[model samples]
Target chain A: MNYLHKELYNLLISDHHIFDFIRESALDGLWYWDVENPENEWMDGKFWTTLGYDPEQMPHKSSAWQDIIHQDDLKVALENFKKHCEDPNHPYDQIVRYKHKNGHTIWVRCRGMAIRDHNGKAIRLLGAHNEVSALKKHEEILKRCNSAASIGYWEIDFISEKVLWSTLTKEILEVERDFTPTINETLAFFSEGKSKTSLLNAYQNAISKGESYELELPISISKEKTKWVKIVGIPQITANKCTQIYGTVQDIDLRKTNELKLREEREKLRISEESFRANFEHAAIGMAILNEKGQWLKVNNKLCEIVGYSQEELRQLTFQDITFPADLDADLVLFQELMDGKRDHYQMEKRYFHKDGHIIYIILAVSIVRNNEGKILYVVSQIIDISELKEAKNKIHSLLKTSQEQNNRLKNFAHIVSHNLRSHSSNIGFMIDLLTNENEKLTEKEEYKLLKTASNNLAQTIQHLNEVAMIQTTLEENLQAISLSNSIKSAIENVAAIADAAQVKIINEIKPDEVILGLPAYIDSIVLNLLTNGIKYRSENVDSYIKISSFHSMQYKVILFEDNGKGIDLEQYGSQLFGMYKTFHRHPEARGIGLFITKSQIEALGGRIEVESEVNKGSKFKIYLKNEKDKKPMYHR
Target chain B: MKKTKSLCIIDDDPIYTFGLKKIIEFGKFDVETIFYENGKEAYENLSQVISDGESLPDLILLDINMPIWNGWKFLDEFTKLLSEPSVVVYIISSSIDPKDREKATEYQIINSFIVKPVSIDKIREILQSN
Candidate 1:
């Protein structure tokens, strides 16, 4: 008996050590309740402490413990405990909040087992209470965060094929808490077509392979509208078989829509840029892009052709290198205005240097490119070659000048003709008046002389007018090569009889090989007129002496005819020397039409005749003709 | 017929002047003839006469083209004279330019614009009309 008592004490000692170990570890608390005697229920000190009460002030019966439980949780906890008491093999587990002595509530997980007699009827209940206050607080925080972030959690049961969704998950689907949805029904809530197919495939893959999947898909919550969601699913695997899929679903509709809009805008910008490049490269007019420093940034093929430079060469050159010196200042001023943001475009008539060292006139239009912030980027220039237009304008100007000069000449000719014809006709009228007034008083000889002089003067004036008309009309044809020496000799020979009668000396200094381009008849008339004038105006005191000389100019063959004769005052007759019917001397042969005819003939052949004279000195007439091939001609008798 | 009180011949041609003077003298026209070589001399003399309160010429035979102040300028100045006299002007011009004829017709004071070589019959007609 003493040995048994010692052994029993050792067993009690080991049991005490085991209980002490549990208390120190704070693993769990134990409690005992007598179901047969309802008033004798007791909780361990650790169990009372887990429920936030002292063991000395612990609740004594089940009713006392039940009174401290939360009113909403008391019924559930008591029912579970009764079931555990009836079935001894079953354990009861529940989470409940109980009030502490300090007036605060604490969360505890209660687990109990039934202690039964030999017939399997439970006599007492043993249980443990674990304080889960910290775990409850952490779970509350997680729930709050999920609701605020619009994130919801869901679980799918693999064996039962049932879906369990948290309250927040139901809110994300815009459904009620009682709504139970299958996997297909859940996929149906996703937008139809590609989004639904993609989500269904991802779900199927996660269930079969226990794979994790994250997808953003559009979801149609009801018939009217749709929204975007980001779904992440992680399969739970046990024994290499998927038991369930747990996932998070978040509403991301706003961000997805914004991303789509941004993509569309980018596509539009790319198309616009392509069109701009095509227009700039293929334009018909010469175009160039220039940097702010006037360096060529880009040059098109047309610009290359205009400047006679390759694109590569032009890129290395500044605008100043090609700009004409005269147009540079004006171009720079307009460019400065563009840079200053005062103007967007400018146009000017300017000149550029051609590669071949010629000036190219152009009408240039320039526009400045700027960014949204109004900073100048570069200059775009369009150049139109206008050199041909300028040349045509110059030609028209010269033509106008020639026409004006011709009009003036025609006016003067008309005036002179009127004056000459009127004078002659008026003289005839006077003579007729005199004859009529003296019809009975005139003798036959005197009347005959008067009639003869009148008839002779009329015939002479008519012949002189005919000669003037002939000279004006006949020399319209272009000049041809004619022998100058032969022409001079022929002219002198024609007047040899008159010269010999006047004892005139003819001196010829003409080069025998000299030739000129002039009308044949014009040369003859010019030579004859000068020779006859010199002989007619011969000085009364001295015998006539004439000098004829010829020479060649750079573009003309010149002939000079000078005579020592009765030279008239040049200042009085210089302007009228070639005027018709203008007589300086009172000689009978001085009809004043000779020099006029000579001048007209010379001018018709594009030649010029000028005279220099002094009173009683010599009159020198210089005639210029175009230089032509030297031709030897047959002399005429 | 009442002879003109004062007759003036403004011409640049000497022959025309001489012939006119001879005809006036031979016909015994009761008129004192005044001759000027050009419009400038005629304008000066006529203006001087008007300033001295003398009678203006009754008839003026004017030539168109002259060295200084042609017939058109003479008429422009002559119309401004203060003296009141019955005057008849005949423009005797050798110019065949139609523009000159048109210009002469534009003047309200010109009695007749005739071509050159004035005939005795025309002159008689003009004198009888006056």
Candidate 2:
């Protein structure tokens, strides 16, 4: 030190160039100050240049450096200098910032020493500056990177039994920078159970065994806020003993929460898939999945049973291959419509060729599966076997046809009976007429009178049979729209003589606009027969009157034939009034065939006959006929 | 009334024909009566008489529902043979069926449709009308 001091003093008084060259090469700059005269100081040229200023433009004075120095850094330097002067053992070294001539900060390592005269009075001060701005900039970048990545450092010093937290670690724990927690307090940030235990074990291993560990653990920042963190501990071992344990704590809450949700979704999807599989396997009806080209991609056991094929066999064939030719086209048309996006699903009764070669009838329902873009993925078909039902329906149809044929034959036989009886009755009448005209004595005989009566009875019976047969043979197709009032008028005209003789007045009250659909002949017969019946059954005690009126029912045009005469006892004869050969009255003209025929005629026109009568007050016969404006079609008897 | 020179009766029922003939005779008309059992027989004999250029009966009674050919079938064929027949014809039927009465009106040759059990008075009226 004496030799270097001798050389530096020799250079300072002799060749000053070498001393200045050594200062420029060894340090950023050097300074000298006169303590007694505080403003008097000298700064080397390198200091000004380091601050982005030309040395010749800077003054060689203390104030020149102080003006460019950071205000906070200047105070630190001054304090350090005062301590150093009071006790030379104290180092006057620190990092200080200076403003560059370009308006940017320049960081420098500044050191100073106080030179004192005899009796410890400081006379001069010397200082050195070294630029460290680039290194400082790099440290700032790393600090920002750690905060951006949500990573923070923590340390446990075993020797001092102290815990240290970085600024970001304090931020993550929601603590103030002044908070200095004990080691146990730091461990309290871990969750109460598994998280705390796991971290404690990892910390113990790190301290005792010098083991490094990484763990994802749950931690609580406050009473209500919880987070998941990836905590890692790396041990620093010295002399085979851990001196410190330090690592990083990273926030992983977002990733772990998403992972948990994904797992739950996967579990739910798996359960749904299992249930769907069970349903598909155990379904009652046949089910199948097929490609758009009609190829079977899958078939359930029920489907195989319905088609008389195995599942594997069905998968080898397309629907078109097994479909009955006659029904295939219709099925294809509907399927095409589904594929063309015209329909979402379809149902049709179709026939298929069974594996055993017989035709099988089925009701097939089909729907499509589609991708998100609306392209068809596949087709799902449900089939129900209907062959047995079809067979039963055919049997019923044939049975109905057979019954209809038998009924027609019976009606024809009735006609034949009437025709044959009429011929024989005509012969009998002729014989009776001849016998009576030829011999008066023969006609006077009791036997001859009896024979005439028999013949008359035979004629009447034949007439009744003919009338019944005519009603049966009448076809609904022969019905015409006949005015009700006109028919009643004509019937009244025909019965005028008889009605007048009996003192029975027949008043036609039917409106002229009322029309009915019926056979013209049958309508006339019914009206006339009712008119005669009203007159024939007239009470001898009162003035007999017959009234005809028309109205409408649900599907029928009703004509009411009311009479003020010796009415029938409805309770006694109501059920038998419309029966053939039924006799209710003692009148000779009560053949008992009129009401029966009328009822049959009404029924043949898709109508009915209803009667209401009292013993002596009056009788009402309501005849229903098909209404011309009604929607019901005429029905044949 | 013009006296009927000849009368023809076509009926399948012998009793009906006999009674009708007896009535015509009892009326004391000087008319010669001819009878045929069915429409076919009457048609053949009448067509022959007309082709032979002989006069037909003044009045002819045709019965429907006969054997071999019905009254309607005979009328159809007989009318084609004669343009305007001079004979007055009547349809006699035992059938009370109104359909037969309505069908008889379709033939221009038929003067009237009469139901069976015709009274002697009706026969007398027919004879005088003829």
Candidate 3:
């Protein structure tokens, strides 16, 4: 009925082109109504077609629209229309759904103007309609995507003094869902100092110069909560000036914190590398880094000086190239073990050939290096040169050898002098008795007795001295690889008559193939002495059996001579057991020189003799000889 | 005491044996004497005596430091033959070294150790004690 006055709106809007504005974009249909005559209506073809109705079949009256509108939107549409008619100055606008001929509801945007005479009463209505269902669906989709991603968008209208925010922006700021923020309130969410300054400058730049800004900054979301957020602002310029600005905002708290921590770790690794390089260059001892090929990748100054090669020169050679030939094989074997993962590190006293062709005795320590992925990379070798110490040790060794020889010589001389003096004194004692005997006259028989005894004692003493001298100077003896069992057999045969006389049963259990480095004569003498001692010390009650057997340890071949005889108390005579003339038992044949000489012979051949005995049990004499197959003579410890 | 049947002197020195022999006779001990200049000769002859079925001497006087088997080696062989014969061995040597004195104590069959120049009194005492 009001649209009957629309002819008056047409005169003003036709020139002003308000209809063309709607028709160009959002207009789906046009309508005019006469307020005085509600049945008088005009509808465009598209108005019926918008609801899937043929234009001819579609109604042109207001009642027809009322009948076709969905019940949910019909009440609100009628209330809007009635209210606008009361005050024609108010514009008419409603969004409502109408029933289509196909029985589906389609959303329509209806905007109209109520034109009235100067009396301010509704006269006519003019409006444009548009189907807005698809546009609303797109906005819903966009809003859902922003909420899921915690992505927020904001816009500022320069001319309107307006600010707009997506739903996520309000959530990020911890504000109520319906809260509308002014431009000042939005800017205040950034922290008060640096953040405020940067955000303000960026916003002004975007609005005034149409420049874009992207920043990650901290913002205060609440009194106690601060969040890291990324913001991107894109300016919309109109007439060469920014009219509006909009951008996306995303919370970046976790990502930014993790990025900062990763940077710190890289910084710490850089610092460690710096210190390692400093230590390597300034080390006091020689050190070097080697590649898998053992080529010098880096050498410290000390290493260069030790090897008498410049850094450039050393880099051209491998570790094996400069090692002494005598020591290279051993050093390389240990090095190869490191590369093969069989060992983590190794150290050895090895000799290196210096640039001057002299040997440098160095203790080399090498350690393995691996990559982050656990692949073998290189090795670090530290060398400590010790040639001076080696020189001093060798000097001491030779000095000790000389002193030991001197001590043995002096001991032999003393024994010979004592023997000579004893023999001479005995002869004189006999002569004095012969010349002045109370029981008989000084006759020719007595004179001849003194003369013969004196001469014989002198001659025998000379022979014994020679034997002592020979045994003392063991250097004069010939050494060879003699079978221990064969030597004992020959010695047994030498004393066979004595053993036979004493009824000594000798059990030679020595392994026939067991050989040792020894002086054949000394072995024979040693075996002979032990056999005689066993026979001489036999207990009258027991059947004596002398058992000779062989055993060995890591370093020495041993022959054990055990006897069931009147064994001496070794604990009481241990100190003097091998002393010349120091006899422990009460036996006429224990001249004692047998054990003394045997011990001397064993020591001279780099062997040792030990005795264990109980008073009534037996005696066991163990002779240990070095098994020197490599031809390096081993001495008694 | 029992009177000794026979005595043996094993010494390389003839004069020492002669002086010992004279003292035994002078003491009126009524003992026969056998003499060998060295241990080897005494050992061989003693073994021969055993083989011949002759009785071993009651007492044997031995000397040390002899050639061809000293007193030590001789005792080593001689003691084997003495198990059946109750021979009392005495070591009489002129060398007064303590070594000889100590060594003479090793043999159980050796009854005494006497130094050189055996006295007439010592010989009488030995005979009286046995």
Pick the DockQ winner.
Answer: 2
Give, for candidate 3 chain A, the lowest lDDT window spanning 10 residues: A469-478
Against the true structure, what is model 1's DockQ? Answer: 0.22
Ranking by lDDT: 2, 1, 3
Error of 2 at A584 (Å): 3.0
Which stretches of model 1 miss by more than 4 angstroms?
A: A1-130, A137-151, A167-171, A190-211, A222-226, A236-240, A343-349, A363-365, A368-377, A384-637, B1-6, B18-32, B43-57, B75-82, B86-88, B95-111
On lDDT, who's better, 1 or 2?
2
Cα RMSD of all models vs. native, in order, equals: 21.8, 9.0, 16.8
Per-residue lDDT of model 2, residues A470-547, tens digit only: 666445566788887888888888888888888898777888788888878888988888888888888899878998
Question: Which pairs, if any, clash in model 1?
Answer: none
Could you give the TM-score of chain B for each candidate, in order?
0.88, 0.92, 0.88
**What lDDT does each candidate get?**
0.81, 0.86, 0.80
Every model's DockQ: 0.22, 0.44, 0.13
Which regions in candidate 3 have their CA more than 4 angstroms from the true location?
A1-26, A29-151, A156-162, A168-214, A220-226, A232-250, A333-349, A372-376, A386-637, B1-5, B11-38, B63-67, B91-107, B112-128
CA lDDT, candidate 2, residue A249: 84
Which has the better DockQ: candidate 1, or candidate 2? 2
- Compared with the true structure, what per-residue lDDT tens digits does model 1 show for residues A118-171? 887878888777888899999889899999898899888888999988888898
**Candidate 3 local lDDT, A1-637, one digit each (tens):** 4785787577656665665554645678888988878787888888888888788986678776777887767777678888888865555787888888889778899888887878877777887898898987787788899887878989988889798987888787678889888878888888788877998899888877778999889899888988889999999999998888888998788888888888898899899988888889998889999987899999999999899999999999999999988898898898889898899999999999999999999999999999898688889999998988999898889898998888787666655554445545555555556544543454457665676666656655554554555564344234578888788888888888988888889999987798887887788878887888888897778777899998887688888999988887877888999987788877865666778778888988878898888887898999988774734555655
Compared to the true structure, candidate 2 yields what TM-score? 0.62
